[model samples]
Target: MHELIAAPFLEDFLLLRPGHASGVKIRGHHYLELRSLAAEEGPLPGWLCRAAHRRWGLDLDAHGSTREVVLVREPSPYGHGRASYEVNNGCNWACPHCVYGDKRHEGLPWPQRAKLLHTLRDAGVVWLELGGGECTIDPHFADTYAYAHDLGMMVEILTNGSTLDRPQLLGLFTGRRPYRITLSVYGATETTFDGFTQRRGAYRKFRRGLAAAREAGLPLSLSVVVTEANAHEAPAMRALAERYADRVREYTHMSPTFTGGSDPLAQQAPDYLHHRTPFTGCDAGHTSLNVNPFGLATVCKISRDHPIPLLREGVAGLTRLGGIADQALRRHSGCTDCALQQSCTTCMPLVTLYRKAGAPLDRYCQHA
Candidate 1:
């Protein structure tokens, strides 16, 4: 007998791909890809049949006697709940442990970036973070922020606060301002700050920028990153950070270089360098994604070397990227019975490092 096929019944929201992967949520229950849903043979659920008929005019009726699967690809609303885009890859300060490392400065043009932002907003991306070598340093920073703001998206900017005091840059936030500005505080003192950044008088510039942000009435927070060089001063730094903003965040762990292993200039700290609780797995590509200056989306900033161009493939591409990230999360055989499993930063990327270079797991582990 000939096979009977019924159109796929996708939920009202977008489905990135099979496996019920990440996508936007509109109303009601979550959406599932037809191909994946059909993989399981059984009586069709009433909800799936109803949604197929009502939303997409798809009648998911397999011949009364036999069942056949159906698939559909039509223009659908995408759900980009949250996203972070690196506006440019040109940092003013070169921190020794910086992983960004020599990435080309091929930022998307202003016009193209504006379109990308609009597309994201249209696709239901609610929370957007604009960051970069330094987002404010980008020539089109204001234009991009204004466009994102006008689209009804909550926008946030991450910067080192080097140019926050610039009159021209300050003007952009004078009117509506972003949801918040996250300033990375390198050190509590000028000498340490300048030493870490390798920029003469950067500390002074950062202070001026902080004052400017306050003057503009922008909501602000401080991010104090812990490194071996600055670990001793974290307590003092946290105290200073609180004075600047009520909300302060501290990062105690540094991952391997994107190229893998230690960077000559941006050296990776010892495995037991600064103290941090062990991480079981990474949520990159699943809960969040990082978009580089060139619009390549990847697992996270640390995993930028492996990236997928998000604009070209949309949510479907995200599905593939998520799978790659998930594979990276699979536990190594050695980790199954290890005593330090909970204390190791033993995620997929780290496992790739261990397998590729044969580096001691403890070398990349956050805990001793």
Candidate 2:
């Protein structure tokens, strides 16, 4: 915990709140309330030690103790250092459980896209996450990659891996990038994948893309979003992930329901009622901004109201606006309760899906 606190870049990038401090209060009421899990000099208190994990999203406890949810310093306002450009929402796959099917936003102007990249570069963003509805389909996809590379930032693409074979996709590297390609692979085989993604040739095409990415020397990782169609294949899927090496990761745990544009927690899982949230605080509103295609800084990726135009004013302006700005976010309970609070990304799309799925307990919760 001290190391993270001492790290120059992260310290500047994130604002860690001392437990119970009266510093900038985002939570309704605040005061130091936690006890250290260990002796101060012996080891970190449980809350502080397990504060840097990503597992809170899956309801998995990183702490050996199952007694605590994570908490984090409140997030720095987003769009300050770098902007998260959400290109569009329409995915090539029509996965049965997909919520964005009806809400995918599209058609971004090229200039706006150019300005977005330049803004991130000028801000000294160390990491730029290129995401979708489906990012590769963006008209300026090649230029976007080149621009990110030119800005000298490490990039990570959260893609479904459809058109990796396109000449445009290959042009992203141009021999000057330190990039990571992530595949939101629906499944491990054609039958399994098709059932989950609803994209007929996606599995094969994804493999082709993986081959291309490997040949390009770009690091690759597979992210399997566990759902009804793919849960049973966890073991086999995990084996496949190993083939991709240390980079492959399986993200099981239910997503918030997105159909009809509902919150994931509200709907709950058919037979589950367990709810898990990150233990850390978010840097979203301050440090990480999820920009809509139109360049609006949404309270969340799934938020449809109170759109703050990031390109127009930037993160500092959004901070002045104040609050989550989402009518749908019932409360920010998840962040307050998880142990891995500091390093969690509470993506709104997943929150919406989790709400709809009846908030079922995570099926294979790693903590369990």
lDDT of each: 0.64, 0.53
Query: In candidate 1, what are the lDDT values of residues 1-368, reduced to their tens digit?
Result: 11112221223443221111122333333223433445554455565556555554556575332124332222224444567888987877888766566744568888678767765654456567898777787878888887776654557889999988888777777664566789987788998889988999999999999998887777788998777676667788899889888778876555544566455323333542554456867557665677878778777765554687766765556666667677666666666577777666556565565445445545554443
Per-prediction CA RMSD (Å): 12.6, 14.1
Structural similarity to truth (TM-score) of each candidate:
0.70, 0.63
Clashes of 1: 2
Which 10-residue window of candidate 2 scores lowest in summed lDDT? 18-27
Model 2 clashing-pair count: 62
Candidate 2 C-alpha lDDT tens digits along 256-285: 433433342332233322344642344544
Candidate 1 clash pair list: 24-79, 328-348
| Over 4 Å off, model 2 | 1-79, 103-105, 122-124, 257-278, 299-305, 314-316, 321-368
